[model samples]
Target chain A: MASIKDVAKEAGVSVATVSRVMNNRGYISKETRRKVEKAMEAIDYHPNQIARALQRSQSYFIGIIVPDSNHPFFSDLIKYVEMRANEKNYKLLICNSLEDPEKEANYISMLRQNQVDGIIMCSHTMNIESYKKVTFPIVSFDRFISPNIPCVGSDNFRGGELATEHLIQSGCKRLLHISGPLDLDILSNRRRDAFVITCMKYGVAYDIIEGAHNKLTFDYFWSFITEKLSPEELHKYDGIFCSNDIVAYALYIYAQQQGLQVPEQLKIIGYDNHSFTRMLQNPKLTTIMQPSDRIGSMLTNTLIQMIEAEEDDPHVNNTTVDVTLIKGDTT
Target chain B: MASIKDVAKEAGVSVATVSRVMNNRGYISKETRRKVEKAMEAIDYHPNQIARALQRSQSYFIGIIVPDSNHPFFSDLIKYVEMRANEKNYKLLICNSLEDPEKEANYISMLRQNQVDGIIMCSHTMNIESYKKVTFPIVSFDRFISPNIPCVGSDNFRGGELATEHLIQSGCKRLLHISGPLDLDILSNRRRDAFVITCMKYGVAYDIIEGAHNKLTFDYFWSFITEKLSPEELHKYDGIFCSNDIVAYALYIYAQQQGLQVPEQLKIIGYDNHSFTRMLQNPKLTTIMQPSDRIGSMLTNTLIQMIEAEEDDPHVNNTTVDVTLIKGDTT
Candidate 1:
């Protein structure tokens, strides 16, 4: 609980001298600095971060807004974001927006009030106007909120192409693509577009099913897929490409429950090579690895740069990382 | 960007009056308060949280240290913790210790410097001396750092008992219990104790394989399990009880690769009933479910109470939540 004044008294120096030593500003004699350091150590004087951040107008805190941390994809994203943020001596204030626009807005305001160095927007529930009006630094993930804010994501179109090409190469004549709500106008819709374009180019019949966006509950999407694609309908497709690994996992479980053969009867490919993809039995999931770690590091570095940049400096450019197709037993 | 001075100038009030209105402290005229509120709205003024926190000697922030958020068990634990923390108007600064003592110590110091109201220690790489010296309030999860610190965790013994009893009832004469490193003296060791006692009571032969603590990489533990139990040895055991769902998942993958049947030829049970457990194919994993959400709420509330309580108040008692045996196709 010792303050700078206490350290100053112990060191037989003025409070201003102690402040200068703590901030490492202005000139100070070596003996005086050594005495102050010794006194600080003797009294266990830990400088208050709040006071220092107030002076510098920076909190060294980054806010990460995600829909749900329990979801496999978000879990990985959060893990990497925290890791990279920690590497730079920054702490992450992780807020789960729960896909609520109002909640996301409130969190953004909270982050601003605390003067966080920057915010990483992994959830896209808020409108573009809110982001445009934000005075603090913000870097979006997958979704481009406005031209002012930079976004970081993988090549979703290429990811879709890789997935569809893998399925077609496996001799799948009819394909099914299950994805998130395409009406959201998010970057991930590019995957669906690529899926359709690739299917048409290959002269293959394909159908698409769109589920609600940001719906973390797996059963909701599972029941939707089952209700829409019946046993007879499912029998028509020799391949299925899910938007993410979790959905593909649900599909794999559903197929197992139905006693349907994989690869031979239905080849499956998923996006986001999540850890659970390898845990599947009989046939492991073939997936598209979205370079999550790369994206996290890039996002963190970009946000930090934006935070440290001069007020009138130009914004950082958007980043698009590449994706890889990982072939497992499913294909 | 509007400071209190701007609000005061626009409201035609003294700076002290504006500060009083913002903090809701001291008596102020109703007309003056209304004018100040209107000024704040018109100027889009957000009172600096860092300055307010410094004045109040509180940050309203809780630090959470976990081994890895990507891990299924920790992900669920973190999601619930963040949700509960947010409900109480506390933001969570998530720190991934990566099971490194040095990293954990640095995070503790950083959290202290920031004047976090409390810290939730879910990763236990630090020594008792560190926890004892933490001047801020702290709550341990799944580990007892000191008698003075309140801990919140599920009943490991009961979880163990449930898994063992289910496997025995499934007609498994021989069983194997795979667990984390038992040398860490963590509360989870109680599960191993319960397993031994339960097996003795049923006169069932059981063996155990201890893996490194917090080693999230599945291949490392999988290789160890393979080294300990060869195919010939695995053939002798009709059931396996894993300490957690993640380890059970790795075991399931190994079993599938080895061409061993689940539930019929071999019954498997896991602890923690993670989301991936039910997502497993064929014999969905039957497992024990820890009351993670309840534990999270209890931990957050207790920490907030300790933070708000008088310094002379006695420490809160540790809490142990009940566990449930969720029956699935695995057993």
Candidate 2:
């Protein structure tokens, strides 16, 4: 059977373009659409799976498992994914696993039993063997679940490099990096790996703090950071990079309490420059901007393709989207 | 069949306690549980609907419609509701209508056709007549759909009175109130109404600016508020009330940009002390604390009862949770 890759090769365009053509997503020029269609015809692209989906009584439901929708990052992810799913006339079955391995496993089985058209795994807490046993069409966010299962996420390594390099260039000799828990071998861990590599390359002294964040209250974050930063220890680092914005805000508050003026005494950069940061954070937090909206759209589109095509051609979609550095008041 | 009210009376407890017993939610003294169970038995409380639900091939799906989960408030609500639903083994089907009436209507119909166990309507955009036509077991957040369908919400009028009173007590002669769009006759609008009443009672000057919020970006909020408060207009109000924390944050940013000191120069109060405000908000945003966690639990319990009973008894749940005043640096 001809794959989306075959269609892309025949169309003389990228797989994303071919997938876009197939999904009717984004602004595909008429010329490009026509070319993609012609290429599909020439390559005898596999019979339309949409028809098969309908014949099988498609549920029109896509299940998404995230660790916690309450976490700002995951909340944004859920919103974007839901928006895209809505656009495709699909509804999202949301599961917040709360980082429980059992809950994640249960959610996977429940999604399977429900016969959802496909599943999007944004929270990957289940064991690899458990994930591999899931026969449903699945795509993950930021985690490599299996070779055949697609993973969608931002270019975190690049994001880490940008944040670290920018902080270093901002005249910081010592740095602190705060990130989500490092136990999981997820793609986002690359951000930490890159942080270490970049710090070494730039000859900057850095310390790392990794903690499970989704379940912790902001009160916990405040007290914990306060405890970590003694009056003397507080001034140890001149710059900080947060894995996400909430932490950035926490540190910003911490610096204020310590009489450490932002940028003057401390410079902070957070990842995922959340929507609220644009206006809410005073002295905007300098951070890496993950395009959650695009990632969400692509995840939904990819899941739909996996469902329709029943094909596990991971290369059909370039799962990684670009991240950009946003200069805010903090740095 | 004995209604939950009947069981509550028999058990010498509130309906909420009976609901707690039935749903196995929250804390109930052993004596209370035993009393509730005995009352349920004596009163012949309707047969267990779990069995009926199973016999009918329960989808174990509860559809929740919000204008946009992207909004922080909705995101938090979604999180809490999803949490409770998960406790009960029900998965939430999330719909972000983006304040589109057509989308809301379509989602309602889709939910009905899918035979979801029930629906929690957090977004109310359709006509009341349309809502009355919905035969599905339905409960709403902050919007009264009809006389029979349950609506779960905070005591907005009380919330408003407290906020305005606090602002007035803080020695504010002039005040500004910011709220979500007033076009929809939703329960939250009572907050604005109470603001008006309280301000009038206090013999203080007040103004309200309402707009659709869920769909707008923080950038719009920043620029719009900036344009609203010109140099002369900025100094006009001594105190401001925001319908939600996001607007409060926006005004907070505005105050800082215009060099107006919070509390000292302009006291600001907002509603809905969201999960993030504990530490993320600087000087903290003095706001009304709407118990969203309790609200979510109540909403899920209400809908689950609606589904299990296949009955609509508006008095099954009290539906109104209390709000508290959280004093922060902003006020």
Q: What does DockQ give for each predicted structure?
A: 0.62, 0.25
- Report the Cα lDDT for candidate 1: 0.84
Whole-model lDDT values for every prediction: 0.84, 0.80
What C-alpha lDDT does candidate 2 achieve relative to the native structure?
0.80
lDDT of 1 by residue, B142-247 (tens): 8888877899999999999988998998899998888878877689889999999999999999888876676556676677777887888888889999887767
Off by over 4 Å in 1: A1-43, A278-282, B1-42
Q: Clashing residue pairs, candidate 1?
A: none
**Model 1: per-residue lDDT, tens digit, A1-331?**
7888899999999999998987667999999999998998789888888888998987889999999888777888888888988877788999999989989988998888888988999888777777899877899999988877899999999999999999999999999999778766689989999999999999999999885665556677677778877878777788999998877877876786688888678899988876556455446678999877899899999998888787756569999999998878877
Q: What are the models' TM-scores? A: 0.90, 0.81
lDDT of model 1 at residue A287? 92
The 10-residue segment with the lowest total lDDT in model 1 chain A = A274-283
TM-score of chain B, candidates 1 onward in order:
0.88, 0.80
DockQ of 2: 0.25
Model 2 off-target regions past 4 Å?
Answer: A1-57, A310-318, B1-57, B310-318
